[model samples]
Target: MKSKVKPLPAEQKEEIATSEPLPAYASEEGIDPELLETARVRLELLYGEVAADWPGFIARPGQYQMMQAALLTFLSAKAPEDADRSGRQLAQLEAGTGTGKTVAYCLAAIVASEILKKPVVVSTATVALQEQLFQKDLPRLAKIIPDLRFDILKGRARYVCQSRLEGVINDVAQDMLPGDMFQDAFIDTRRQQEVIPRDRGQAMRWFKSTEKKLNNGSWDGDVDSLAQTPDPQDWRQVQANAHACNGGRCEFFKSCAFFKARRQAAGATLQVANHALILATLQNESTLIDAGNTLFVFDEAHHLPSIAAEQFSYRARIGTSSKLLTSLRTVALRHGKTLPASTRPDPVAFAQLITGCTDKLSVLERFWIDAGLVSAEKDVHRFTQGEIPQDLIPECEELANLLGSVNRTVERIAEALMEQDESLSVSERDEQTRAGVELGVYVSRLGTLEKLMRSWATHDKIPWAKWLEWVEDAGGTNIDAWLCASPMTAAQVLSKNLWKTVSAAVCTSATLTACGSFDFFDRMSGMNRFPERRSLVVDSPFDYATQGELRIAPMKHSPKNSEFSGELCLKLPGLLLAHEHGQLVLFTSRKQMQACHAALPAALEKQVLMQGVLSRVELLKEHSRRVKQGERSIIFGLQSFGEGIDLPGELCEHVVIDKLPFTPPNSPVEEALSEWLGTQGRDPFLELSVPRTGMKLAQWAGRGVRTVTDRAVITICDTRLISMRYGQALLDGMPPFPVVRPRA
Candidate 1:
């Protein structure tokens, strides 16, 4: 079949082709005043149209302020002429709930993008928010701003590769077993893949139906667009992946769904993406969109630091690597057969390297288990101060060198197979494609292992947290050990990869500050390094003082006491009965929440819904349903439910917090950071734990009074709120709710 991909529109083509010079107003004052006036006029027009179209719309002063802040920050983007300059056009906005931040950023970003001839990329922390923007907000905005163009940016794995789909379909139709000589070599991860389907007929039917939908244009070829969710293992067989893609070389290149989406995003004035996708595409300039020239608006921006840290982390499993190396040896030899003798890769040379690495891995795994560093009782073993054992450093260096050589050899073979060729037959081309895809997997795996080994071999000034965690199967059988390494902080990573490149960026969230300050956030996010950046704090529309009250309950024991959970069991029932409406209980630990739930009376238990019992969406829906029917409903959730949840008006009339939400230095990264701070004579408790906990507490308290009409009570059972010195700081971070506490 011929490719039926359509070309970009004439204006979009022109927009990409043209390279207009920056406007003359590139100075400390910001953009040209006339261009700024034009944006202001458009915004006023939008507000007028919205007010006329919706009778219920009530404009708020805070929303207007937020809009203005966004407008100026975005308009302050550095021009292409100043791309090599040091200063950045950045803004950190802490817009309270109900500030309408989404509309504010969208309208301002669109105007700035047009004025600057740059794309606006809005990234959110959660899929729920991303969906809300794409499905509801942007579509509505497009109706008002007639010519607005936008697209959602998803990872390649979310789309189907037509070449892979066709190959699988042909293999099934021919009755060829999976993993046979003629089969495609692009295997999914061995951990989850069931290569051969148990029910082959059913699998074939689903694949054929999916292919039909793609052909008929009923579906956009997005996995999320399907009416029914396909089995994960089955979906992996045809999922588009970077390791297997051949760009324009494949016959399906023009009609490819993933590439088509990329093209649309390239032409779009606004693109909605998640934090993970935005960070992942930074290293590769041509992926989703160029970070260097685009204007970025990060919604829920507090998550960026942690998300960036996770993205830069590396992990590899011991047992999995061993099996992967064996497979790589076979794949390299097979793919190298078609290359010229002089240029062909030597399988024996790489095989020896792979063997040495595997042997060293086995030795290390045995040594750890024998030393009780990691066993059944203890799954994790973090190196103290991010330092590996001196005795094992030499072995790690040897393994690093071995893996590095193996990766280089595999990469050579893959490059040879993937090279463009117009003289080959159809079957020969298919074979070459399969060979390239298979070798590509080994190359990626070897690269990860090589990086991991190198990290473990040396200790740097900016330390990386190194650790080992054992993986267990369903039956509690030890399967493998994962060696992991991550940067202690994301500050340097963001400073180098993100903050320095983007034309301008606006990082906004409802809870960007802790204890009336952005100090904690600035240091963690690397924003403190830029002195010229601006910040603003916008108040919520809700009247917290009149609409809600903070209640510090009398407790027999502090939350740090072992008897706290028991006290919660005794006090919670009465609180639930007194409310006689929607209520939410936020707990810091799962074990404590479960214990409190088990102790509830039958009537109270029947009225309650726990977090793990149902999906978050379903749980919130059911809570809303019961509240609407005038029935009492309570939700028991952990820290996750503290934020990113909506329960306006009567849906949540009271919120009960079991204790202060303070996380210990549990993870390797946190441990290393805490240790380093302690050595520097800094109090980690005050510098790290308090600020983070204050942010979480504020989020939990904010859930109680969500609207101006809401009359709710926030109950904190922890005695620390009144007894500890840090209590005032935590209280200052929350909304200005009236206090109703027991007499001292």
Candidate 2:
């Protein structure tokens, strides 16, 4: 197959390769008034056409207003030559669910991009939403607009690297077994990967099948295009890694799956990708696509801060270190044996260096576990404040010093593998190229270990929280521990890296405000840092007070009381029988959800569908199965089911919340965030904890009234909502629902 669009011209390609200046762009104030008005009129027509094309499309004022706002924001940044240069054209919008936010943003963004001569980049928080835009929304827009071109882009790992595919295929031809190789395992300490497979044959078959599928055009080399989810172990081995890529130099470069997709993305007018991929590609300043001069729409935009923090975070795992050392030995011998006598690296010297690093890491790992700093939980141990206790600072300091020497040796060895030699043939270079890829893995690992030890040795490091968490598998004595450090807040990182660069951006969600203010989101997103920005809150068209009622069921004991579990267990059986249609019972913890399930009678248990017993898909399917066939179905779910779940109409009619959702006090990330806030002379509980709980409560309640016609009753078993003073604020902050508290 051939590409329909021509590749970018050489000069255009060069611009994409280079980084642009980040100095503030031309202001919207200088733009011609007539031009802005003209753009607005055209966008209005496009939105109207979308509404007219769809049957029974009852236009809501909120949806229409959101579209206009998006158009204005995009146009506000259009100062011709210097436009998109502080990229301050930003808006924090709170468009409620069912407001048709997808169409509003998509239609407005596409039209504005065309007028401004820039690509439109729409990022979703989840793959499901990404697919909806790529397959459903974009295709619909393309039909109406004719020339509108869009493509879906994902992280590199989501694609099968053709180079890796060819290597595995050739390995089979040589009768090589995969049980030994890791497909050039790219060790990323920040993200955990599955262990290697036991059977080489299974991996060989998967690669061959995938290659065949791509050739026949049955699959697009996209992991999502597969009929079934591939096993994590097999998928991790074959997935593409940027660190392992040789770019245009690889033997399989012409047919590379990842780059092929990147090329396609560069040609499109609008590129839809998940948040993680967009963040990474932009930060790396890669030439894969034109990132700047694009309008970015972050749907489910609330998750941006935390996800960005994860990207900047570093980690060092115990077992991964062992694997690193093992690979070091394996690669040294394999490459040394192939090279000519004069150019070969010394295998004995490299072996000793690898052994020394391994032994030193083992000693450090033992010291962390044995020290009293770690607090054991269900399966893991966490350091409370990310602090390496007072007594262990000396040991940690020594580890940091030792790691510096190890890092230097690893860098030297990796470089030696890629060094050009006069005696080397083309074939030797190919072997050297492969060896260099393996060397990159250890070199990356050594860097992470060094950073972890350096941070751990420091005391009273605010914002930068350092800790070690060790997890022991059930019934397995050998445990895996990780040394981790992360910023408590992603504000600084986002404001500097992302917000400063894009031409214009719209950060939006169904719930972005708390207690009738955008202050929480503004501070969290670092949008407050920008001098000129706007915020909007579009109330849901649904009349929450008329459509739903929140009933506070009085309990004899508070949720934290010793007898509360038994009391909840006793109260649920009768309450379960009272609700008709489908019921979604939300819980704060899995243990409580299970405990309440155990208290139910066998008949009620038979009627209930639990989250853990089946796949979330199967659980919903079974619940639907029971509900439609004239049987009652109730879904018992935890935090995951609280938000981003839709069971509209009769699928879900009643919502039962057992207790208020709050972050665990000792959780590493939250604790660090709290500590950081205190140092800044701010009340951590009010700023961080309260807003989070309110958002979650709003999410739980939002589940009940998905549409204007939706009518349901929400019962809160905990009496704290009305009893405690702070709880009243949470209740007041929730969407306006009529209260039915008899006596508190």
Candidate 3:
């Protein structure tokens, strides 16, 4: 196979080559022509108003083109009544930085949702972007359309649970009975140990202050909304969680903070969420949003595949799980004693079930140890092609059945404890509620182990990666073995779950294409399965030829050489000193960043700020403060600082990338994916690494030029940009910056 290097698209095309004509049903029936015409008129009016009246608005052709393309793709969607019809209602939109992509998609999705009579759900990959949409972009659009309403819905763990908070404030300050075995068992079974504040007086005061704020409506019960960041351990004790939630049965359900937000989300025209929450809803973990009747706009859509894969994977520990079962059994017996005779769970029967599970688990652990599957020398043992030893299947099946039975018995015990008993004292009621929540947590853990065991017991058509990892203590001593399994790819999963059922969707990102094509994203995101899916790439309006230049620093060693860090340190100082303002030095690895930082001169080191020393937000703030004070500042960061950092004008006048971000197949899932691809006679490096590296390079280079008048320079320390054959392909994926090469 030959390498094909496609140059960056210079302008937007009228029609995407891959987009097919709308299906006959969408064109001839089930759509109201009057409604579409009204929507089009409203969209045009809004765009015109923004162009004329909005402050700091630039007249960019790319934004308009993107808006038109997005609107058309959405208009081609099949209505809810025609969901089973043969039509794909997805638009793969890639808008470059500074293209106003968020506003473009929001307007399009909102209008289409009105016409289709479905709610719009926009999912982002990061909280910052989600905040920008809800707090910044949508508010501006809402002014244009007065009726526009949107709400942000995060995971349940973000809010405070009033019930838990009251219990913590009331009970934690008092003494407990001395010889209470049930109490000891509940404490042991908890995943998070109780946190004892160092200053109990100050802690109690803070808790009272927070409770008062919740009562006075000054605080919304969201940790993020707090003026001061609460201690994470303290927050975990009172945070809203699935295990602790009794839903409508709770005394505070009417005013529950998480439920209040969910109720608002149900009524809002648009709901903003993150990728993990959306995938969690698909997995039936929670029902926060209705996927079937919702139109979605996924921003930063490139992250969907990895997030989906992680959401579906399962893991369990052998030793820890055995101990947890024993503790759960004890808690179950104690709680059974508290319930009435008629409603009480059968403690003897439940104990027998748990004992069977523990017995099978012990046998499995012995099999792993005796069969030499896990040892001190090896930390990870992955099954080839996801196939485990034939002898282990029967044991897995037996354990799965026993665990399932035990899991059901635990659920029954939890429900029995949930029943309200009028005769119980206040302390007894509190203990019962707390015990039920712990049992709920155990039920969840047992369900996870059962799923992993079932996956091991039976084979599926889709490929999976099964592995055993030896868990070690901080002193490097082996403590337990972990069983893990994950699918090779999430493309098929997304296609079956989302694309086939969703009413309509648009996946947009700044760096979706690799090597000037959407083939990689299409395959990885499961969009390729829908041949009728439309795609459009809108170039940034900024004139990169004048605004920025790319310089390939001359190097004597390749990035793979041991001396490359030395080479990078030598080249970066002059570049940093010349800018004398905001400078970002991105490294692919922490080891390299440390090496380069240590080698810098004393004066330069004083001016440098490295990641992990301060939080990302504070680091950026400190750098900005120095730059605003007319002082030189250089930031040393890794992959996390590559894409989301926004420093325009004098804040960031130069960006120095140590080398290409080439991530090889290191994890079990990636290795299994590469192995599967290789068996089909494909080159994993070209298909996976190159394209992914291309996207990273594009994102890194984009940080250089943010606004129209802002000028900056991007310097690449690695020689591969000009020395390797595939380097040109990576270059073609980046902005059309003027290239400066070293003289021969």
Candidate 4:
């Protein structure tokens, strides 16, 4: 039998996770005329202030043009009751580096928000950039634009959970529990294991030290505000979790640190947040953010697709049900006795629920193994093109139904716990509060399991891919398989969540366009869904031709060939010494990066900083220190160092790339997407592969010349630039540098 699936409508523009007229698009109605008039006047006055109030602030025509595009696009979308409308917002800008982009977007979004009466939630791809905007740029703008208020906000995990802190402080002097009492509540208990620290000395020291700072009014409870960053293991105990919070019922409610910051954020005219947290807040349905009413400004907007994919992705392990069932048995045995007889969840029912889930999970494991989908030998295997081979659809559908029933049972258990919490006597308030919070956690897990199973069984759902893969446990143990589902494109996620629902939005980035067009991004990001979308490309003011040279080495092998790593490792040391000042060698894979780092000469290794050896901050600090001491320094890094890393002038005189940054040859999602595209008669290599590689190449070269006068040479150790058919297009996409071809 065929699996039940949601069929796409004939005129459906794209496949979305939901069929509801979910959020999207722009409308020309409901704008406040008077507010727009006032904003228009403010823009003129702000233009004069930009040239006057800030030091050395040049009024680049491109910057003004960007602001104009933002204003016009938003004004065109202004409408009353936009949250319920079917309009798609269409404002895309490619403002290259050094175009004063932050200032341009801030002014435009601020003025537009004033007219639309919406908060401008500026989402960035990195915390460093978010901090830079909040600390450096907004304050500069506030000086010139009166009453321009902004707040830098992050996820609750970024703040110290006051209750958890108090608990840790109380136990600081106590000898370690039988198991060290380092219990961590995992949001997804199926896959994530609780970390057990070997020692608590560091954790206690950090807590005591932080408590002293807080008492003396030196620390503000922010993880970033601490003088010394807490060790990640130490921070885990104090990080906020939905499972731990008791809200107003807790004694610490009045002094809650995260909520105070959240309050300030909600009231601010603008909010600076990283993309992940912004998506988290929305997915969590936090009252602090009004997704439909707020105007989202996506900075580093090219990252939207990957970020959204990660946010929307769901995974469930085969053994999770058994583990959770066992945990539930313990909960009922130990804690169920505390509840009032009338309110207690029936032990029989709970057992049945747990047993049913466990049995169903076994059935799933057997089905996958029987269908030859998983192997005891292969460490990792993905479902081909995210499709359930014809013979397996029946088993998948049965598993889907079992999951739905399990989800319902989980909900009932939560409801029982919540009911008990609501009926608690004054003396039982705290105890019930804790139980209610636990219930909240179970409900979340139930939703995750149900959603993934539903998406997997729904064969014809548009743009959602499913995969089954596993990694062998350490010490040659059992392989743990993960059932995963993710949206093929982020555009649909954004369109339904941000674009269609919000009154207006502006997506700005340094490198949004790939292969000299926005079509790749447009298709991937659902920009085509917007009723009336407009895009603007403001080139960088820097003269790339005068500043940098592109040097392509005649390599004996491509990255696809086994000999490439050894050849590059041998050549990099001499090039590192030749550069003298500072250079960054970027690798496409960690295996390659670590191999090259290990193979470097002992003397040269001291001056070479490798990723994973230290924190990014420490590495940058060490690099700067070496450069300041007038010593040669080089950094060996992965794809992360390709973009958003700034090293101008002598700090970075050269950048060497070991290979092109191409998507994996067999990524299930990409393959599934390419297959779908081909069904529509599109070229996968040109449309999907080339543009992604070109953009990464551009970002890699972009690291060398951060300033207008900065001079550097970019060394690419691949000969494919002149040898392969599509190599020239990728090379052309990099900054326009003088080319130097090595003799064969």
Candidate 5:
């Protein structure tokens, strides 16, 4: 069945092009003009109150106007006859960093919700902004608008499974009984380590007494947060033993934390969630959040396309057999028993199973990769709608069989482990049985993996690519190249499920427009064609001219070879040597990062906080501390350092980008996807790569100016941005800063 919705008609485009204003809805009959004016005054008053109440809540000069425009557009839709018009409304407002976008969006949502009496869903790209909205922004707004209720909606994994926890606790208790004497030595050793170093016996006694505290659902069922709990290993043991909760069917369903959280959200006026969960809900996984009549505010909307892509992508590795074998062997040793010499798990048999599966996976991966790459390399167009190559049919059949065989082998291995348990001592048998259980888990995981592989490889609508990577470990033999596949672009997956189905959506981002155009964001985000949609660009209210300086460095080397790194390494020192040192030196690649760090003088080495050496938070803290102490310091980092960093005043003075960050075309996955696109007759570079790179470079450059008071010199070492045609688009998307070009 075709989608009922079509792209915005030509006439509608002309209407928008002509800059025709939306009709005034306040005069419409049966409409409460006084009430509408009260709502408008409330919104304006709320903004004023926020600015007055918070020290940092300053609205830029044009911000009030943008907010009013958005409100008017929303109000126009609520008018009696306007509701039946069946068209999406769009408002583009560029509220700069300090302009309090959260408050503005909150006001918009509140006003609309009160008028329309429907929930508003706000989606953000990063966790930081999501937290800000929930923790700081929404709470403050809620105090002002007492009638409005809000809830944070995260992914299913965020909440703890009460039934799963109970099952785990029961399993651990049952296993501790006298009959189940066998225990893996590694598990025992791990338990022992939990005891205090000096008083092991006392620690064990204390642990036994406090074990009940672990079962109270305090851990939140989030594995990451569980680490901070006392007796983390024991907590993990409980988690591992926990059964797969079947929602309502499970015994502890009523008290399930996840369910409770969801129930609470049902009555909320505003729902806050990450982009992934939002898409998942739209895909029909759950109906907890209503999409229709909901207004979605996507913060950091730039990363939506990639995030959507990852959600719909799938990958399977072939070297899992080797890892499984090693885990089985460890289980056997820890259980105080060995596999019978005559019938030991045959490595050759495992190798055969892996090779067979890999051969099939390789075919699917290669086909898609070649199709994407060939489409790109050959400059093919209109490749989205096409059939899989006929030659790949045989390979697909082989892959199906290979996946079946692998699944069967994993099951057999698990069964063998279970059978061998009878011959061991009680303790040994228990450990062996647990090993069997572990094998069974792996077997089940493999089954799901196979199903995912089959679904992606054979699915008609989703474009897929297969690629391989080799991994090595210190104590292990060289692993075979692992094969995997994923969708060519997530937009294709989302377009089929969420975007096409949604009645209306307003996709807004600060950086949506390129040179006053929404073309880049629309195309990359897969929302380029929607007949019911409207587009707007609201300029950021930040004073860029006074807040930042953009400098184009005179480059002596091209970005193609090793010489570029050497030249950058030599030249970067000169920029840092004299500066009062809070500098963020961002490189496009690891090679350049390393070269720059290595070439620095010994004195400056102590001052250089390089990426990969420490976590981002750690590096930032150290840099902040040193910069505050009046010591010169330079932070050398890659992509993650580009944005989401807020350092004002002297804590950061210069932001240096070694080159325009672009995706490397040589990646196996990219090459394969490009080839797959090519086979389908698409221009992979323009459709997939270039626009993606353009977005990244823009984000990278955005780090230079954070707050209105923050002033820094942004040095772009890559001359290509100045010389290349596409470079203007990247520059134009950035804040309106004065550019300084060095004389040749």
Candidate 6:
């Protein structure tokens, strides 16, 4: 009997056929078959060269096929016009983690850009990946393909402003007074004093020494590396006194590291950058480096929408006004300037503005507090009716009026400062000017509150309440709150910005589809409506059935009870002891992680590594060393440890999750989102939470199996996996394995 290969799924076959097609222009030109074959041979030879140079690295089967598909899609889009007239096309490819996806994508992008006479923009989610591409992959590729061009573009904050550094040094030398009295008051506190010393001369000396070592030239312009910690006072001085950067106008523009890097990017065939900068470019229509003829490659593309939301979200706090007041006072006191008591700009007026805003915010907060109280007083069964107390309307109206008044006052002050004459001395005028700019920014943010108030009053989606609270900060306790209306979906806000406007886009990630369906990711990303768009889900080539085992431990009680963490802590030590170390125990909540850390036996505690207390790299290194030394150890981490962590062989033999990590429905933001989705007649449970949790569970499970030869056991202790209907979705998302029920 002959061995038989399994047939490809209908969907997979369609994806392969549709992903590529012969370029129309190439066909019109009647390109010779020999020439096309020669080009293909050259591409293979280039990849072979890379493999020969890197002794252990080899391209997996079908990797080239994926690359060809990516290239053909890109080239087809560019066939109609000159590079200048072609609109960029988006194509998503789903290649699993061990598929050498990065190299395949990079190779395809390079070839497509060259063939079509265009550039390629590659964007990724994390800096670690950015580093991997720039430091490891790109350089290796460049060595093999000598003509390839590439450059890395980081956000503006990554680079140090030469003028700003000089200004900070000068300000420290002059013993400049503190910018904010509130900050001055905290100077005596242990945290503040220890982090930022009082000796101005010493601080300046330290900065100068560090600056010299850097030679005032580093790509990305980040100042963090030069100092042990960021100093707010130093940053303020730098912002106020630094020379204006005119891009190409500066005398130092030629040797200027940032500009030099940008120039290099302009000439490169491929450019790598972060999501924020890329989105900002698209929103503003200003490509950092002319991408007129470029195909954008978005890596870890699932994060694009969330990152875009964060970029567009507005935030404001009570101390913004207080800080402005303090800065204004410092300038006035130094200039010996006194204005007429009635109409003159006084620092107290600014403070009063903040006080009035806080008072108004307090009213809104009280309304919510009373609402919570009323809900508590209602019959338990009546809670489902979703009625708002009629008494809260007047308070909401009054608070909205107060916020409006505060916004106007700030805007008026900003106008006066902007209209002021420029004849004043640098010290006399600069601080006030900056303060005015900041006030304008806040005035715009206050609009969010106004919008929230309107939505709440009208009950746009669902009945919800807005609230605020005074929270402690390093300066002092300050107010921050949600201008929240009942739960709203991020999809509602993101759909217009991300989904509708783009002519074409490709979203690729290792974990996008859940339970063999892309519906979950599509809904969350606001891409569900594009049913005609192409998608693919390629499985990891690693054989997980051989490399890993799934074990579900039986539990006697629910995980929701208060004593669950303690119980888990008690149960974990024996498991760790049996496994003989190299264990990673993940928890959904910080409180649980802390309780487990505290409850572990002293000997076990000594061998356990916990998150929050140490950096990720440090924790991983310590775990690796302990496992190498043959000591049993457990590493406890939260969501940060879920994905992107790779540990093969004995370094990881057991993976344990405390429970399913679901977004807490009570969280103000999530609650608002859920309520909004409910109003839209969508199943919030299946559409919003289940898929998100399922994706996370899959990511966490992936940490266990990294290589074909690796083997480990995964234990999900939560009883819900067996009891809940949605548990099947989570289980189906995982690699296929035989189920085993442990003896109670």
lDDT of 4 by residue, 90-201 (tens): 6778887778888887887888777667788888998888998898889989987778889988888888776667667875312211111123111233345445554667
Relative to the unseen true structure, what is the Cα RMSD of model 3?
Answer: 6.4
Which whole-number lDDT from 0 to 100 does residue 669 have in model 5? 44
- What TM-score do all the candidates reach, one by one? 0.89, 0.84, 0.89, 0.83, 0.71, 0.73
Candidate 2: residue 742 Cα off by (Å): 2.2
Give the candidate number with the greatest lDDT. Answer: 1
| Distance from true location, Cα of 471 in model 2, Å | 5.0
What lDDT is reached at residue 197 by model 3? Answer: 47
User: What residue runs in model 1 are displaced by over 4 Å at the alpha carbon?
Assistant: 1-38, 79-88, 171-205, 284-286, 359-363, 366-372, 420-423, 472-479
* Model 1 / residue 541 / CA error / Å: 1.0
Estimate, for each residue in 1-744, the C-alpha lDDT of model 5 and write its tens digit.
322221234464344334535532112223357866777767765665666565455555345444554554455343322334333443434444665566666786678678767677888886557767788778877775677799877766555544334434345323321111112211123225444333436535534433443456554444444444445434433333212234453345576556676788778988888888887677544566655456666777767777886666544434443344344334433332245655455666655666666566556446445555333233222222223456765665665666677667556555555564455687665445454554444454455456555643464644565544443333645333334455666656655565544423445555655544566566656664543344555455557788887888878676765577777877888777757868888887787788778888898888999988998889899999998899987889888887778777787788889987767566444665677777778888665555666656666666766666677788888877788786786677666679888688
* Deviation of model 6 at 684, angstroms: 1.8
What TM-score number comes out for model 2?
A: 0.84
Between 3 and 4, whose lDDT is larger?
A: 3
Candidate 6 lDDT (Cα, 0 to 1): 0.60
Ranking of models by TM-score: 1, 3, 2, 4, 6, 5
Q: Which stretches of candidate 6 lie over 4 Å from their true place?
A: 1-48, 76-88, 172-202, 210-221, 224-257, 289-293, 318-504, 561-567, 594-606
Best of the two (3, 5) by lDDT: 3
Q: Which regions in candidate 2 have their CA more than 4 angstroms from the true location? A: 1-31, 78-88, 172-198, 289-291, 318-372, 375-430, 443-447, 450-461, 471-480, 601-603, 679-681
Candidate 5: residue 537 Cα off by (Å): 2.7
